[model samples]
Target: MGVEERRQQLIGVALELFSARSPDEVSIDEIAAAAGISRPLVYHYFPGKQSLYEAALRRAAEELATRFVEPREGPLGARLLRVMKRFFDFVDEHGPGFSALMRGGPAVGSTTTNAMIDDVRQAAYEQIMSHLDIAEPPVRLTLVVRSWVSLAEATALLWLDGREIPRAELELQLVHDFAALCAVSAAYDDGMAAVVVRILEQEPLEGPFGELVGRLMAIAPTVMEQVVADDRTA
Candidate 1:
């Protein structure tokens, strides 16, 4: 193989192993063994174990960063549903590696590792915000976006650790959670309220927002009935 091909072959082998195990647990010989190559051949592409680990991480990180990049031309809620589906798909495929990337435990983490992870988070945040078309969002709006991004990361990590929650369930919940946060932010802050209303107004009734709004309407009577009954008793 050519020099570049050899380097990528080794990196690909390292990625598969690293995804299945942690950095400390994987070694140069193990990677070479998996690659069916000599130990020295592995070193020829990467200087050392640390270098190989970083390369593997970078490979994963680049793919992850691209995963969150979605088109801006769809209904906001629909776009979110698309992104959530893609997000969970990545989680399902890269189970162990996905968890390691999100948590960044000190055991196998360094500045480079954390930076790559952060890049994924930041990319997700920016992609979501980009749909809003706001050059500068308010403090509360920023809080809503940032909070949801962190929540999504934690949710994905938990989903990896405990498979009890189905991926589809998590995906649907995240889509609703994001809209709920937006509506909540809008309720407390007029600036946020206007922005959210504007986005939701553009959404068609057949979209995810339509379904969620229908659910809200269907339950409104029951919720208001309890409040009214309590007021009458008082």
Candidate 2:
């Protein structure tokens, strides 16, 4: 293989090892041995185990972000549904790498790695909240957006853990769950205008005041139903 190709091969091998075991658990020597190269050759590409681990994670995150975040122009709900499915599909194919990212099981420093995860999270949150029709510059709206993003992250991690779930079924469940959250968020937005007017004497709420609060409140019941339904199925 060429230099770049060999480097990627090393990365691919390193990811398998990293996913199968902890970062500290596997040594550079082991990776070199598995890649059928001298330890010095491995060093040529990655300085150490930590470097390889981070490289693998970056590759995985970039692939996932590209698949999930690119190609817009659809309804927000449709886009999210597609993204969610793509996420699960990626995890299904790269279970160990997905596990490391989703669970944070690897020992890689957050400085380099967490940034990518955070970027994707923020992008997803922005896309989701943008779809809502809410009064801008409102407190309730901000809260709703925060709450929905938090809920999506938590639930998605849970889905990652339940690797036994059939891909089709998992996607279906996510769609239903996300739809319910959006509905509740919308309901909350509808009621929030009145709620805000009622509490007008209080501090001013800002940014999609109605829709934000709606999305946030909507996440709670959806969470409850998810737990209950999951329990029943379990």
Candidate 3:
């Protein structure tokens, strides 16, 4: 096999083993034995078990990211539903692979994998914000995007660990939960807008509160519109 092909073969073997057991539970020797190769050959491909686990995780994340990337110009709600369906479908088909990727432990032990997880989180955030019609400066918007992504990822991890629900059922629950959050954010934005309007009318300028309120005010209408749209479609 070519270099890339050989590398992929090793990754495949490692992932299969990882799905059945924790990353640390499967030793390099065990992988070599499963692949019918000597332990030294395994070492040549992956310096250690950690390297192998990292590669397996990268492989899974890349596969998932590819599955979700789609045309971005359509209505935000439609795009989100499409992406969510694709995502949950993947979870159904590749549950073990994904579970292994996320369940792999502390970031401190493997900075590379930690960064990889962060990348996955960021990508999901972008996907969601894209679907939310968020069109603010990237730096300013990161906080909102990051907060929503945390909620989604945490919910997904919990579902992954505990439930074996069918894809359709889980998708319904996700859409319902997200729709509620969208409504709450929309109402908060509207209230902020009223505060900003009060400040702009030169009635009172409450320093940081005024500035913060103004920012939320600017996005309030757009957020409400997006929430209405998502509720209808989702």
Name the best candidate (by TM-score).
Answer: 1
lDDT of 3 by residue, 65-147 (tens): 77667786643334555666887766655555566566656411467876887788778876666554434523424554576
What residue pairs clash in candidate 3, if any at all?
none
Which lDDT tens digits does candidate 1 get at residues 46-71?
88787877887788888877888887
Q: What lDDT score is found at residue 145 in candidate 2?
A: 58
Q: Which candidate gets the maximum lDDT versus the true structure?
A: 1
Q: 1 or 3: which has the higher lDDT?
A: 1
* Ranking according to TM-score, highest score first: 1, 3, 2
All candidates' TM-scores?
0.91, 0.64, 0.68
Identify the runs in model 1 with alpha carbons over 4 angstroms from their true place: 228-234
**Residue 163, candidate 1: C-alpha displacement in angstroms:** 1.5
lDDT of 2: 0.64
Compare candidates 2 and 3 on lDDT and give the better one.
Answer: 2
lDDT of candidate 1?
A: 0.83
